[model samples]
Target: MKALLILLISAIITWTLALWKTTRVTSATELSSLGFGWPLQWIEQDQSRFQWASYPQDARLTFVKFDQLPAYVDWGLFAANVLIIACALLVIYFSFPLILRMFRK
Candidate 1:
């Protein structure tokens, strides 16, 4: 039961953080910046034509036609985050007994 609760909590936290970070991405650059050290230039989009290049570029400029990022990328990041957080939590929970024993000595 405790392990299940831990997993549930980890999933919730991971999903919340993922949504929060994902919403902030307005451009390819912002998306690439999500999760520590995500690959630079992860998306390959065509550059604006020379005639239109002189205009000021905004977030939509990077997106071009896409309204949102690829679903697979978002899911992959979420899964990775959940795995990392759950592993960290399990390590701490399991080693807690050893830590307590050392302190009692």
Candidate 2:
């Protein structure tokens, strides 16, 4: 139960963070700045740009088309995040016992 809870929490957190990061990433520079950006970019590169209510043609009006985003982008980021987060969780789980023993000394 404890391990399940840990994996659940970690997955939720990792996936949420991945979604938030990818939603705003429109260009290579933005995605490349992230540690997981390379893999996420590798998954897809067909980001669509759009402009809404562009009376003034401001930067805010012209942005990536998040509403019409592709499925691969979302799922790709989530998959990468899950894999990375799961690996970290595994390391922590396997080493936690050794850490506790060291603190006992």
Candidate 3:
């Protein structure tokens, strides 16, 4: 239950941040890179579309809007990423104590 709660909370927070940042962005050019551990920063480009991106560990840099595609695509990717990370964290959180106990013996 705790793990679920943690995951939900984490997802909500990350989604909120990403969504909020996304709103501030008007063009896809603002996103510089995609993948893990990239800090969100402003990068100017000629593109005028939207793309959904996910950054790890509160790092910035995610979301892009492209012409013709639905905004939901980006949001879906964002949600998936948030869930993946939350799940990973939940696993680590639960396992850490057990791992420590094993090593202590």
Candidate 4:
């Protein structure tokens, strides 16, 4: 039950962060390189993004680009993320008793 709760909390957190970052899309269109890491990931727009016009008559819409697709659907990355989170939770679960013992007078 603790692991499940931890997983839910982690998912909520990452989802919140993803939404926050995505709310403000980067204006820079030039992709210098991939920035895949624990903190952030910069996959190619070509890999998981598509160009779409927000308005039919807007001139700037012609160059539309999305930096990320939804994370939930991306199974490979999502699974890896879940695995990392589960491991972290397991560590916490195992060490929690030790921590409580240390706190006792």
lDDT of each: 0.49, 0.50, 0.48, 0.45
Worst 10 residues of 3 by lDDT: 35-44
| Alpha carbon deviation, residue 72, candidate 3 (Å) | 9.0
Candidate 4 weakest ten by summed lDDT: 55-64
TM value for model 2: 0.43
Where model 2 places Cα greater than 4 Å from the true spot, the runs are: 1-7, 19-74
Whole-model lDDT for model 1 versus the true structure? 0.49
* Residues 28-82, model 1: lDDT tens digits: 4443333321221122223323123232323221333665433223555555666
Model 3: lDDT of residue 85? 71
Candidate 4 local lDDT, 6-105, one digit each (tens): 8887666554444344222342332222233233432222312433344221111112355433222354665566667667777888999999999995
Q: Which pairs in model 4 have colliding backbones?
A: none
Q: What are the per-residue Cα lDDT tens digits for candidate 2 across 1-105?
A: 866776687668664554444334444443323232322332343333443332322121112555643323456566566667777888988999999999999
Model 1 regions more than 4 Å off = 16-73
Please tell me which predicted candidate would have the highest lDDT against the true structure: 2
lDDT of 3: 0.48
Model 4 / residue 64 / CA error / Å: 12
Error of 4 at 49 (Å): 13
